[model samples]
Target: MGKLACFCILFFNVQLGLCMAPDLSILIVTYNSRRDIEKCLASLRDNSRGARVEIIVCDNASSDGTANFIAQHFPAVNLIRSAHNLGFGRANNLAAQHAHGRFFLLLNPDTWVEEDLAAAIVNFLDTHPEAGGCTPQHLNPDGTIQVGAIRELPTVESLFYQKTGLAYVFPRSRRFGRYCMTWWDHDEVREVEQAGACLALRREVFQQVGGFDESYFMYFEDVELCHAVRAAGYKIFSLSYARVYHIGGQSAKQAVSKNFIEFYRSMCHYFRKHYGAAGVWPVKIIIAVSELLMLLVLTLALPFSKLLPPPQAWSSRWTQWRGHARLLREVWTF
Candidate 1:
């Protein structure tokens, strides 16, 4: 849409004004997310009723014919096909090329957006000039705030807390919970280091930083991109005003049975790229040894998993970490 047309459409409430062409491009990457994609699209339609929203879905060679299904069902959404699975960031980058919106909202295929989400986030960013990106608070399938979606940057101490299970053991520690930022209620808006599940940024930022590093096949790429955004002097904000129900890890969890080796690999790449001459070998070693420790602790705790006095949320995290350790055993190269 033209500049005047874009503003006129975005500035009015859906009830008061007619929805026109999308001012925000909703970018999604689909990799065998057959079960989740249908609801996701429906949610977009219902929640975005009065907004002119551009919906784009990039199918990464899914075996389940996810692309064709989307094309047949959601004809208004732009569908892009790839010969091979392009990982997460690559596919989004590919779809972004076709975007005509003023802002880009990178969404996961397994998420449901609230009615005001598109308007709230876009309006907030439009008013706040320096904010490079904004992310909604992620909701679980049960509608509670999802933990670990927002956090402080990774540090030796926070990594220690997470790897050693101290974060679970001490759920209230601001220091131990640094990486997860567990103390905060998430009811207020704030700046954060990472929020990938449902994130938004201007087209200029996407062009300025480029797509995620191809080396990070799936994970940690978001964190790396956050680093780049902040390095460019743009703040990353968490939108407490909006939310999305994220199924979380529909695609990544499929590879968890083999152990999240790809996930770990991405983590190593991120550390090496940002840490300079230090290289990844050291990070690799720490991760390997930490996974070993995690395996031992969780194995011992398995029998009493139900008996633990810790909050259910912490137990959920421990279960996830256990899966991480299991994958590390098979995928650990060094």
Candidate 2:
């Protein structure tokens, strides 16, 4: 089918509400993601089984022709094109409005789903009424377990530990690594406060919590959604059986500086929204001091980096130094 034909079908679905809704709607948002979207869609085509699934791709005004590629190759997909780059949360919300599925799966363009992943998610949600959402085990492309897939809500102490390098230095300490749940081996089915990257949630649950908080442009939207769902008395779960391979940083790496700044900016927004300014004052102080200290150290080491390894090269260290300086300035006002 052509682009016109796809739009016509989508229009009829919206106006008439005539088609039967599917069991799952896998929603993907793309911005210059043609490189990964093809393989991601192919995996879903080859592996998804035992469920009625509909795939929707919301293109965020990609200059790389990502929208055209999907329209030409994956003609069955319901594609929504935006005029500008609506950030991650807004793009997914736009896709969800066009979706007709009982469950919504927020899938990253960089991931490939396993054969039974969709079916398993449907069955799990059907059986566990108390669970509002669930996330699969995220594995690196090399097949190693991806840590930081599940975590608790960030608090002052957790943010301090993360920024000051205490979390990395004491990965297994329950006190220092509580936010990322670093002590857990990621080998069991259990309740969690937040799950990142990809997740599946009931339509009602998503609607009830008002979907991803559109205030976030890049990071912590998932955390905010999970927080709202838990506050509404639904459990967020991590399932060890289902797995997805993630090629991390596929999108963010394209604009490293913007992403770095956005990460810290979103963190401050999250803290303000949930913890209030006064509640998270200590976190702001921690971030400012840590980033400032790193910037100063990197400045002093720039001259010596030429004598060190490539990782410590002047160019690399200078880039990191600039990122930290910008990050420190970003959080200073917060």
- Each model's lDDT: 0.79, 0.87
Q: Mind giving the per-residue lDDT tens digits that candidate 1 earns over 150-225?
A: 8777755567678778898887788777788888889998988888888898889878988576666788878877
TM-score of each: 0.83, 0.91
lDDT agreement of model 2 with the native: 0.87
The sequence of per-residue lDDT tens digits that candidate 2 reaches over residues 1-334 is 6999999998988866544558899999999999999989988987777788999999999999999999999999999999999999999999999988999999999999756688889999999998899999889989998877778988888888898899999999999989888988988999988876789999999999899899898888888888898999999899989898898777777877788788777888888888787866777788889888888888888999878675422248778788888778777675
Question: What's the C-alpha lDDT at position 86 in model 2?
Answer: 92
Collision pairs in model 1:
22-52, 259-327
